[model samples]
Target: MQMPLLIAADWLLVVCAEQLAYWLRRDGLPIAVPTFHIPDVYLYLIVPAIFLVFLHESRMKFRAFPLWKMTQAVFHAVLWSVLAIIMLMYFGHVAQVVSRLFVAMTGVFAFLFLIAGRTALAALLDRYHLFEVPVLLVGGGDEADALLSTLAAHGGCGMHCIGLVTDARVPQKAAARCAVLGHLADLERVIGETGIQNVLVTASGADSDEQVRLVRRIQPLVENVVLVPDLAGLPVANSEIEGILEGRHIFLRFRNNLARRKNLVFKRLFDIVLCLLGAPLVLPVCLAIALAIKHDDGGPVFFAHRRVGQGGKEFPCYKFRTMVTDGDRILADYLAAHPEARKDWENDFKLKDDPRVTKIGAFLRKTSLDELPQVWNVLKGDMSLVGPRPIIRAEIPKYGEHFADFCLVPPGITGMWQVNGRSDTTYEGRVRMDSWYVRNWSVWIDLACLVRTFAVVLRREGAY
Candidate 1:
């Protein structure tokens, strides 16, 4: 049940599965099974190496294994197996000798074996609580209560609360559930006695100076000293400390396409090519929109808004004008008069039946012809054919720190969010889709989004 033993057992299972796969591929079965020429030793190295790389990339340590993490490891193992088989066929110089069907069967067997082993390990770990870590909560009042609640929710994942340590006198209700050993001064003594390996302090109960002192004192005793920020709802960008004192300032950065540079470049190239090819088709639709807008209200045919683009740069994004002239002014007055519409506008940034939209504009928006002008932006390199949707300055505040990180790449005319659900999705859902795109971007992914966008546009799904 110890961490080292658990890790050793997992490693052994992986090794055994690899060996079995090798044996199956090398030898013919007793019951008249087909045999193929296979490089058994090569896969032995390939499978483990791929698993190790995935493990490192995921940042999962042996002590804190979770079922979800284990499932991901198995999934990556399968992916790597497929990749290795492809490489062998293409470049291993022995494709003529090996049966392609046999190679495929080996991959499937290996994948199933990996998944089964991990799943079994996960069940065993959960049943026994083999990797659970003893944690000592240190705080008081509502902050302490909130910490307790969070620990209770995620208690299965190696975080066991021993008790609480508070600066102020513990409330009777909290004391009933968790023993309050002592105040801040008793932290070190309590941790030592309880054999606690982790100390978690809430920012609300512990001030900056006290937090610093607690960290320094607990550093030598416990495995880690964790500070839970006061702001529970806000997303925290992953942060790191660099260099020694004087240079040791914290750097906060969002998790993005750090491992996807090559894919991003390929995607950008694909975007350029698609935009160029679609220009002729998109131009005529844009012209028609321009003519329609001109005929309807005799106003500017295009709406140019200063939008946050790549790296938070302000760029004029073009769209066919979908609203009446002075629509911005009209919006404020209309929202004031119709409180229900204002509430909906606050939630979705859209109004279903607004007087501001011209008749032609309604038709254009329904079919998404209004977005044709953004193809020019894509051609001009201000945007991509696929990426996060650009937002105006007014919308920046709503996105908070994530806004800046989202702007690292150019905005897109059609994106993962747009194809997935568009205006029907919640703000949080949109953020998740955008983040997913940033992390998993590829040329193929872009193409897939474009293909799906065609279907979405045709169905007019999620269009207001």
Candidate 2:
């Protein structure tokens, strides 16, 4: 197994991190560097050893390979590593023997070096197609095909599809890229021969009884088994196990920790701090935009429309007006004449070539300059800096089942929907994305979304 190799790499990375930290501290702050020295550097070996213990204890090292998950593991590992160093110093009666700055620098370096090493190793493995887990699928359908394609598309996923075990003699196109090893009855024999460690069951059109039997049989044989929950359509946004009965079943909920007061406190604090820092950078551009709007259209520079906000409360969502004063009238006449335009409006509530937009408005929309005013919305707490897009009262039913989840947090000026496909995404996709944002909200995710928004805007994708 590559498990031992990964562990070994981690240990070496930790050592390199500590050495680099010591060198940096010595060079960068020579005056601040401790003049005293410990009896032996060998005593510091406990840091890496502590990392291994915490990695196993926290089980952070054992999760499935996702970049985000790996990042979290690295952070947690480094955190525990620091704690272990403190404990070691305390217990060994050498608390003052080591420099505080050394410990802090080592912890930071460990995080950076470990992540860099893991990333480099994964890239090498992916490029050379080495150290990949061989696996086979046991299904045939769109969902089955999509899963196979997804794995094939992402090399870092670490699974290579050797073949598939289908219900038929020949596999479909989804599994056609591989091979039809055999039917469900041949699963055990095929796995035994091929040494397949992972089995992803996505057998569509097969009888439920056959699926149950296959699961029961395959569970004991395979090292890893993943059920796709095909019966339910992608398991609602932010859905997680609420509870479970002993040896029976589990319950799921669409909500998470949105009610945590501390989380909200941090979220609000972040918004306020960010808004203050960002205001100066955008102030000049914003003033120029207001002047342009006034010069071009002789109308209001800022637009404020009632939008459904947190808890179904109405708040004026502000924007630099990008449409003509008679925008509504223009849209009505256009939609009445063009079924295509109306259809698009009914679906995504947007027009690709909206006639109601002024020339400056089009430019502002494409460049996303029009959203500058919504920073005020974020400042006022009516919206977040990153969240679901603000909706109108009429669009409430469009959120449907996800309304409560959507309302759990304030809408954001820039969010998952904006950074993703924006108006190009299907209405259902947008709603589901909002639900996902609510479910998966985190400080890192919010920051990531904000960063991605810049790139998306530059690309001008899904801009109307």
Candidate 3:
């Protein structure tokens, strides 16, 4: 039922995209752009059918994918669908007659409309567990509890743990969260009784041989069998599993995407292009911020805090001055006077309501306009547009072993920490997020972070 509804919703959005593209080409928008050739609307109605086929081929209905996976699948489907349409048009000798602008606009609108629609649909389905796949956990303890917590946090993943089937004594924490239906011996009976569609086998104190046998026995009972390996907190984003010796042995390959020379060049080019394109809009806001800061304090417009950059190099990170000249003294004095505030500062190095912040600075920090001057750092090659957050020398000990990973990429104006929670995130959690970003660095991830940054700033979330 869920699959059919999702497919219908997707088909409808594709049709709507075609109409919107036609409307854009036919009618002029407020922004000026070249438009030519009146597109034949009826001739393009077959686009939705073609797109739906490509989407189905992408396996969107196979499993409940996380939001990121769903986005990637939809993007690929739309891209391939557009290419197929172009090829078909060229072969049919209709490419010259149809408006090229209309064709391009349709692809753009299709992706936007599909993403918006799918996100709304996923949220709606999650509210009622309409599309969730019920699965039985074959292990119970810390492993099962951790998996349960992750599934609960990401409801869009479409997995729901129905019960546990471990032979060992269930830990109090796991027992409290999930029902232990039966032991490993009753795995078959449990599946029959509960009508479970999938089985998740976790490595919870089970020997390799026992685990393998359990998987083999359960494979015949469940429609899907998912193996949960102990590979958490590792960079598996750009990894692949290869089977050697006629599938007798298998090993996972992890690629260091950031280390590639071509990727580094591309990342730099990406930063420069974005900075150049955004200068016109950013310049005006920067001017306004500079004026407001001057009016509020009659001090310097910019502040450069010393921070550790790529390769553990120190540089002055530029920002609109959000604090007074005597901010260091004010912070020290305030922390000494207030133990609670001191504890908070020692924990995250941030204060929700610091007395040192000027009136204009508070708004600037909330809106993230204070960091506009960091564009200079970006252009100066001191920073990338998206990477790990710049850390101070005092915080180096917090990162510990992960500090090396953090130094691989230049610090960012905004990165996983800024987009995820910023000041609200724990110091340790920020370090973890930064380490993850460096390990899993990709052009797509950077672009996604940049897009999420705008939404985070606009909503004024997790900022001082």
Which prediction has the highest TM-score against the true structure?
3
TM-score of structure candidate 3:
0.91
What lDDT would each prediction earn against the true structure?
0.69, 0.78, 0.83
> Candidate 1: where are CA atoms >4 Å away?
1-261
Candidate 2 structure, TM-score to reference:
0.72
lDDT minimum window of 10 residues, candidate 3: 30-39
lDDT of 1 by residue, 147-186 (tens): 6755444444556667888886666766766888888788
Q: Look at candidate 1 and give me any clashing residue pairs.
A: none
Candidate with more favorable, higher lDDT: 2 or 3: 3
> How do the residues 296-336 of candidate 3 rate in per-residue lDDT, one tens digit apiece?
87999999999999999999999999888999999999989
Residue range with the least summed lDDT across 10 consecutive positions in model 1: 232-241
**Better candidate by lDDT, 1 or 2:** 2
TM-score of each: 0.46, 0.72, 0.91
- Clash totals in order: 0, 0, 0
Output the lDDT of residue 369, model 2: 89
